[model samples]
Target: MSRVATRPVTLPNGLQLQTGERCVADLGRMVDPTVYKNPEQFDGYRFVRMRGTPGLDAQAHLVSTSPEHIGFGHGKHACPGRFFAGNELKIALAHIIMKYDWQLTPGYKHRWEEYGFGWSSDGMAKLLMKRRDSPEMDIDNF
Candidate 1:
């Protein structure tokens, strides 16, 4: 006789049915279908200025975060290292944007290789950047 094994499902509040790795919640189900219509389009600001559903926490400021966006992982078992990672990413991006003009070099091509389900761009790729001469780009009467 052959033995059959089955995996147990996890509940929302961190109740594990069967012992295993951290819960793998389906992050996609929590997204609002209306705002994320045709989610494959990849609109970066899709969740900006969104309001919480009526009767939910009236003060819930969910502007930047949505269940649809899994950049920071999800649920109770979410990445414990995310707080540090978030701050680091923001600081690095701010420094880069404030210090230099970032753009892809002309005629440069980006090649990628797939690892697991994700792909990563290969090589240094040679970004072209230049320092800004003006202190303020938008303000003229400074």
Candidate 2:
């Protein structure tokens, strides 16, 4: 996970853009509703409606939000290790949640670092966790 940069660098137009970013694309921004019925909701099942349909190759597919899912980054610079990292993170977090009773302090603080155009966890608020005997909290919940 990344955090928004706190420092401000000058822009060509002298306008300040927030350093943090978010996904800005959706069906309305690309596909037409005459084709996509109700195009606004994030329906995980939306793809189910187009199962066996054909005739869509590269250019047509380019208009889709499917394969280019940016959660894995984009283009040649995209992470090459994402698949491994994803599984590892999932396994690790699952193990921790299943084996420990962890809670944030009522008033907690965090630190971060920024370099180049990126920011990362500062290692502060490392975590407060301990093993739990009860099996009530399932790792699957994580």
Candidate 3:
């Protein structure tokens, strides 16, 4: 969280204020309908579409965090390890998908808990996976 303050002043709204600590929250801006289409729905391809543009492509990558995405932060303050983290995630996901057949356990449901400033899921769902290298997978097929 970033802290900011305003010098003593009053104007348009006639609201008065003195210099004080302010916690700037960016999540609301991230999902604002004015800034994003279908803000309430998850669009995995949002950045992918933006990447089609020339200049924007450079900043649309997962690790290139900006004001539009504070997950890794923005500018020089952005997380330096984001590149390594993104690559590791991709490699892990690729290996998992290539090596196993998996599914969530029956009757499982997703749930999240709201903390003061964030939300977290317990991820209680169980996954049943089987190796894909068994007799069911014919080696000669490749």
Clashes of each: 0, 0, 0
Candidate 1 vs candidate 3: which has greater lDDT? 3
**Tens-digit lDDT track for model 1 on 55-97?**
3332223222335555555466456777677777776666667
Give lDDT tens digits, candidate 3, residues 2-91: 555667756467866568845455677577787677866779998898899776786678788767778888778889999999999887
Which residue segments of model 3 deviate by more than 4 Å? 1-25, 134-142
Clashing pairs in 1: none
Worst 10 residues of 2 by lDDT: 58-67
Whole-model lDDT per candidate: 0.54, 0.54, 0.73
lDDT tens digits, residues 1-142, model 2?
2445456545566866465642232323224465555754456555554653564332132123333344454466456777677788878877876788887665777556764344456655546788877755676565
In candidate 1, how many Å is residue 105 off?
A: 1.2
Best candidate according to TM-score: 3
Model 1 regions lying over 4 Å from their true place: 1-35, 38-42, 49-67, 109-112, 121-124, 134-142
